[model samples]
Target: FTTEDGAVNAGGSLVLFDTATAQQLYLKPGVFQNATVSAEAGVSDRKLLDEITPLLPKDATAQTGKALADRQAKDIESGLTSLNTMLLAFAGIALFVGVFLIANTFTMLIAQRTRELALMRAIGATRRQVKRSVLLEAGVVGTLASVIGFLLGLGLATGLRSAMGLMGGKIPAGPLIVSPTAVGSAFAVGILITVLAAWLPARRAAKIAPVAAMSSVHATASVKSLVVRNSIGGVITLLGSAGIVGGAASGGTSGRQLIAAGAFFALIGVIILIPLLSRPVIALVRPALKKVFGVSGKLASQNAVRNPRRTGATASALAIGLTLVTGISVLGVTLGQAIDKMTTDNIKADYMVSMASGDSLDESALRALSKADGVTALSPQQAAWFEVDGEYHSASAVTPGDVEQVFSLTVESGSLASLKDGQVAVGSKTAKENGWKTGDTLPVKFDDEKKGELKVGAVYKENEFLSPFVIPKELADEHSASTRPEIREIWIKADGGASKANEQAVVDALGDNPAMSVMDRQDIRDMFGGFINTALNIMYGLLAMALLIAVLGVVNTLAMSVFERQQEIGMLRAIGLDRGRVKRMVRLEAVVISVFGAVIGVGLGVFLGWAIGRTLSADIPGYALVIPWDRLGVFLLLAALVGVLASLWPARSAAKLNMLTAIKTE
Candidate 1:
């Protein structure tokens, strides 16, 4: 036990640690005097020696060392947790995106060989057998991707580990690991997702009647489909969205993730329901557009509207991709805004000073540093998280005179003067998240046996992370002078025009300070900007892969359409329609499809992105989102380009349809 003015006070202590658990106990003499003594018996290997020694008390010294180690380890752990979540989400998105690409490839292959499958059925093969063959083909694709994806995952994880370290995040002591569980999850989920995505298209092949084998072309004119007001798929979709929104509204981490996952499924379900749900609308567009654009335009519009199945199938692929991309982008922005706003309001410091050693600077150095040229003010701040009333609350040291000059904090209730001794100013967001209000008294235990009551000052809406804070520096010094606070960063305020202050110059002049890293305002913005940009790209890239699947779906659908319409094109050539006209028609058909998909994608993507950004901002600091207009324009242009590009080969084939030969094929 250390004495403050000869009054005995046991320092905050860690009482339990094992392979599975670790605990730190902060006690007060009246309520928790024997906490260390009580918990010491729990650890078999590292039992605490209760006896205090003269000169250097064994328990007190060990406890201090343990506390430092624990805090560092926890910081490192928090960093790792973020890294893992980012990667896992990316991996899931990549897998989900790949499903469309692979599914399209299989679908086209099946469509092309429709007559073949029908022939097999005619020759005694069962529908179940045809389904098996199609499923087997999908299985092969899944297996190949899994192997490649796994290899990439390992390499990616390695690079990711190094990148995190370079970006001021902690790196584990060993090489980046791939848990068997993660690998197994990827494999199982990947295969299952692949097979399920292909099932519908595969079923289409299996159900083809034997008459289809004898026909050289799909009898689109003769084939009939059952008309319905609403598809079963569409009903499931609306219900799914309701379930997801309801679950998310219930709150908590699991609920949020479920909401996201539910939305993903919702989009997929919507895609499946598009044919039935959009049929009436498409039929309406056909005649109305026909009169507006005349014969050729009318025909193109009619064809699009006529085959709800094909058009929806093709359009839905792109829609799904666009929705995901847009949603993620929007969410990134909202998250950024929420976090930034919170940080801005909470951090009210004029400048924050760090005192550490070796490169260690402490109270003496801060006193010297605080009086440096171009330094108008400084707050020597010490901060830590402690459990109070079964919840984690931040504890800080603050003084009376230095409060205003340092933290510019606006009290919602109690005055900054009220922070005279044991008062604390809580953040507005913190208060809301933790259900705290003004006039509520909270008791905090620190230094093992020193318990204190901090009267709540008025809540403010600034991120304590961005500015000087609610507490005073002297109180911070006195509290942490004996038990050092973990001081990894410092907040600084410039004396001259902040616009003119040369932060790098000042930092260089100060020399190397081991205890802290100096960062200017621009530095913080740039650092966060860099991370946000990287994060945006990562999210975009994953969704882009998903969109690629849609592109493939486009290529697949158009190829099938081309073959199915070959005779018609040949007949058109025989009539007055030239190669150019036929090709134009095909290309127009593609444009029509792409426009529909792109519009939907833009709408869905924006909504999802905004919602996600809002959620993220509330959770993490420095994540404020601003919508990127330039990117939005780029997204539209890219969709158009990909649409035209997908039609390259098909356009050539459709243009070159041999009149007599094509006519003879049927």
Candidate 2:
């Protein structure tokens, strides 16, 4: 019923195509968008819906034909809503931070051209003309940048899809769809952000008095303004601190979210306070600079503090990136340590035999493993998840002998051996939560519609791997209707040490079971630990992209600073400062600002990391805050390198500036 090329073939002999093409090809009725039948006329569509509702899935719904069409449209949109939201959120964050860079650039540019603008205004240019001129210039730049960025993003999207495929993602091959709405939105957002950023600078330039055309004097920030700014920043910092403390005591997902929100608020407060702090920090470094590089260091320090707002704004961008990197590093290291400790302490068995992902073990394999040479004891474990009082919980069925021989069960009240048919052992935390005590009879319901009541025979200490509620193997088999239950793991106690524990014999006995593996305690830990490290490394890689953007901001700030100081640099060269000294001064300024930002970021990150770790430690067993000093040292070194590299172009440009031209610049 469809043209051959127009069809979407999904295997077999069948294909799906447009209805118009189908009708033309077949010349027969096939399927409409929807169809309905009735026994008689005058039956409302509502009646048809009711009659057909019973045949649908429980959660599925039916509607009138018009409503059905609307719902179909909504369903199509609903599929992409989550993906769109994620993209927008990420883009929003980058743009929000990039605003600081954009505003800073415009501020510097406008301030340097103040005299030129005043002259233009004196000659004949109206304030509106001057503002429009600036805005128009910004618009042209924004449009070109947006178009180029959008094209680059398309390539990035294709690269990301291919990268995901290489990483074993299950993405289907399809033609890349570039909708007009998406392109329009990207350009609109970019231009809007650029124009808004330039608005304030444009207004300031237009407001310059014509009399100021002959003046080159710069104004210093007022004390009252500094006081008001610092006061507001302090209040924000205090509020954020309070939120973080509150989050530490709070529990669950909401608490974690509060901690994240608090960190963000605190960072913003610190950035706002940077101008107030910059002068004092630079002053403090003056003595060291004077001692080391002599006059050049003194000059660099003076330039760095000339406009505290400019220096602070430039540093704050780098600070934000470093804070996140440091925070993630601290958290990852702490988590890895906690897991290692937990696994080492809880697992007492000499060896463990288990299947890898997407694999299972049969009864014969279990029996063969149990009968292997040098195996003194074996515990077979199987999972039978069940519901109790409308709450789902993992319910493990373990052989009775394993509790005493293979595991170190710290029974709080009753004996572990008391667990038998139709009896269960609950962890202390679970018992406290559910109000269950030893000797309490609990109603249990399995997925297979089997129901039973089990007596709580014991209450043991918390275990992350083992189920909170444990049942006997025989009871699980009798209640569950399945022909065979897959064995999750078999804990083995060797008569000899783990190395000489006849692992080869156990493997050989399993014969054709290629999926199962025999691993000792350390091997088991490494298998899981490897997954954790891999995930953490991937997160670090993604976070580095933010740092890359921060580096760009640094470069932009330094380049503008070079342009603003051209006359001063020319005079210094005329007096006697060599090109090498000129370059060194620029590079040194970059390093000083970079180090200052990194120090502040690292300090804040450590505090946040420690607090977060403490909060998480309450819920997670064996979790403790651990700081890797070596990693932090490497981080500091990397920051220094980034600073030097970021300043390379600016330093070279400042050194190579035509002294004659710069000295004559207005």
Candidate 3:
């Protein structure tokens, strides 16, 4: 008998039982099945874990906490660490970009306040006092901004908590954590950045001579500075180039890390070289601008190169962000293309049935699927590892009929029909490496003391799916020690073959077999391809944050430029240059700098991407260099848009400047 109300019927269930005689099917004293004892109410969790530790195997790893609680904490901490690392890296990048802005702002502000600083020095203020004053102001501003930013970060974390759940993280909800370390670190970083960025400007301000206070002049980068900068940059570039070459020659994880390090070093060198190259690049582009946009473009071009150091700094900020964005895009596109090409070129089977890893396909299930409607041919294969001359190699055993029906084998000199008991087919590449030809006997040994000399039946071309050596199933079964030969994959060919139709028929025939999945060529590609794209998407999202910071750098530079050139802008306005022309000039200057950065970024990104792709292709077989030209075009267009948006406020501020006041001011 059951309760009148069921779970879905909007009421709770109730069970009736006799007070004295009703019995449960089973009873347990603890929540877990394997626990020897439960902790009393007064006992601490750590004490219970310590007691249980001695009862567990000596080699077993354990931690102190409730099982669920420990697991939940581990999962959440792991996820948070991964997420926090990525965010902090991006934050570091933003802060790095902000250095240029902060330095430039302070430089411009000090230049404008030269007279005021000189007047202070002339009166009673010491050089150290002036420097201290500036640092104190920066500290005040930094502290306030850091506190506000920290509070905002709390709200951001709340949103990210939800995002973590969507990304398959199992995060347990509890009281929001606000660590002292995090808060202190945030404040320390802000203060450090502000102080460091303001240092040079403050030093320059302190050196202002009281007599020269009336004069306004700015010092250019010294010849010695240029020489030292170029020499260091060149050495770094050479070292990075060497690393790339080394990475290409090497293989595996070490090679990948080398490549990343090389790319980073190369980018740093390029950033250092930007100031040296900016003027020459501007000279090269000036002729084209003069011929195309005429006077306005010429004027805009002149403004960009007028302050080469500042222009280069602004461009470098954008370049750093774009380099990473383009690099990741290049790598992702190449990987996806390689997978597509591998699928299309190598796989010839119409349909494939595969079991879960470590699971064997049932013989009865295979027989039933073989007799399924429209299945004209099926090739069941078993993968095996064999030792040849003390080196291990992977090979698969398949029937001869399976090759003709499901594979496009390129037989170099022998027939597939020659593959018989105690014989194998080797790939052409493998045969050449091993110095073996058709009809030659090669001693091979399998696990369980199964040893035999197998003749090379045929040599086929190397393919992604085709192994180094493929032996006949009959030969494998005869010498194998196991009672049952486990089939891992079955290649299928339909009578009236269309991949979609064949796939549907196979899926239908498989019925409720949860262990196997029916897939076609495209499906196989999607399985691996999806992972690459998802990784690329996550990276792109992170880089977008960096790019956003770079955009802010552009805005900051242009705003400072407007402040420095108020008198010049007023003069132009007084002399009949309209508001629209002034705006156009500022906007054009931003676009030129942005384009310069984009061009350099794309060139570097493509070169690095190609180098890495070529290195990986040595192991991956058929990977080819693939450049996504269309995407680069879109990236360039977006950079231009970023320039326009970055200039909007700065241009408007310049255009709306009071002509009389600006021209009259010192």
Candidate 4:
């Protein structure tokens, strides 16, 4: 049975065709809707389908109803799943950071107010009441920040969608409404993070006696507590990592392998060991920085190592977000570079003109197109995709002697002079990776039945975008019985700038061919990989926010530090603690936090970036880790600036404290 809808591609009936006879038989004016669209006939002949066929395009109502049902269900399900995954990762980062900030801030607040809390206890206030008061304060602050952050996230997601839209990717359909469920979830998360952040300090507050608390003794040995705490956490972390790696190597569950064994283990290890790690890591640098980096440098190093928890908390914010964002960005950048190179390879034409519906373009259309002004060269490609062994793949047959002319290639081993060798040519990359050698028998299964056992003539380095190469035109025709291409894409090279004049001429000649999509080489980047750009832009924005949050963490940590040291700051101010020195100290603290974060963040990014490269072979494979040396420098500079900026307000706040008042408070 056969069918053709010349004009009203709108709807059509089922039909059959005979290959050898070049005959089409119309059984009836009928339409059939099946589970899959039939691109070509297979084993079953027309006689079988025609015998049982009905004369209808299925039920118009049922056809559309099924389509709508499937589409909506898929979209809704996929959209929710995507949203959940994205949100979970981001939330983990945000919450981990929030935990640090809340803990550090509460610790600082309690320390500064140690004498006050002790005095309160000395009076009539119970230890429970003192702890409760502190908790109440934290709750208020956390609630406010979370509400603000959620609202900000709503706006951020919209901006993200718009950026993606510009890159031509379909985001979740409909307005990205803030789901009430999401809002409630965020609120609960915020409160929980706040309460937990204050938990330890509240306990400390409960334990302090009036006089001892007033003396700053609860926080006096905090430095020692930090060592012990980080030590225990570090042991657990290393043990957990060993377990994960050992289990994963033995083919344990993939879920646990990727997450628990790999990502989670690394993340937990970093967070837990961050403080101890920062000490030795920063220790080696203090001497070098002290002599040359000036006073600010020395102060920065001192403050960074002074309070382990605060430093860890501040750095953790940047580390958490940067790890994930950098991981993804590395993947995107790798893919981008790979795809661009691929595009440059596979498309060997100044311009590609293809039917939107992928209709066949015969020699006649090719000739017609060539007759237009300045049409110097043309290449035609035929593409068909199929699946083998459950793996989907594509094969393209092309006759571009000018493929070298259009998309230039370097012959690594075999000569282009040996083009008609009836051997299959594979990319140098593809050949080397697959252990393919010249003169080796390469078996390729085209579709289901057609098999080609071609000798690997020569490995050619494909610098442009391409798939596996094919035999020359005549050999291909004989092998496939001269089966005409159902679809053709034309590449045109003209005399002038992308052949603007000739492009217009060709468009006019093919004006009636409504099913065609034409593109010049210039449009390749935007049209071919627009979605990728959108994803990058979204990530860049998210990273920017994370950086901002990191700065906020720095500010929060520095501010609390300054507040805790009000008396010390006041003492300095009274006895030559230059307001400049005070600012320097605060700024130094900020710098310390930023530098700490940057080292760990950059290290994590590079290490994981390398790990991620193992998943791909197109570009720099086998742990293709790049330091992004430039970005690292920029991050370092930005961290310094963030330190100074974060310290400014807090430094002034500390400098402004009255010596008498500061001393009396504790």
- TM-score pick, better of 1 and 3: 3
Best by the TM-score measure: 2
Give the worst 10-residue stretch by lDDT in candidate 1: 5-14
Per-residue accuracy of model 1 over 1-666 as CA lDDT, tens digit each: 233321122222223434222212122223322233233545532344333224343544434446656887798679789878876776666566556656656666776687888889988999999999888877887788788878887887788777877876653355466788988987888778878878977887787787965585342423234333235566667766765665545545665676677676667767766666455655555665557655555656666655666777677777777777776666655655554465444544433334332133444455555555676555544565444666555555544555456444655655666567556677777777768887777776543335666667657655445232355554444444233444434444566635335454345445655445565544544455466667878777656666777777777777777786777778878887777766666665676676677766777677555444544444565565567677677777777677678877787798887888877755
Off-target runs (Cα >4 Å) in candidate 4 are: 1-76, 115-141, 144-180, 207-211, 221-224, 236-260, 280-300, 328-335, 338-351, 354-365, 372-377, 385-393, 400-488, 492-534, 618-624, 658-665
Writing each residue's lDDT as its tens digit, candidate 2 over 184-267 gives 988998898888878877887787777864475443356886789899989888888777777777856777778888887888
TM-score (C-alpha) between model 1 and the true structure:
0.71
Encode model 4's per-residue lDDT on 335-405: one tens digit a residue. 66666656765555668887666456755666677677777676566554433334444545555364455
| TM-score for candidate 4, residues paired by index | 0.71
Instruction: Quote each prediction's TM-score.
Output: 0.71, 0.83, 0.79, 0.71
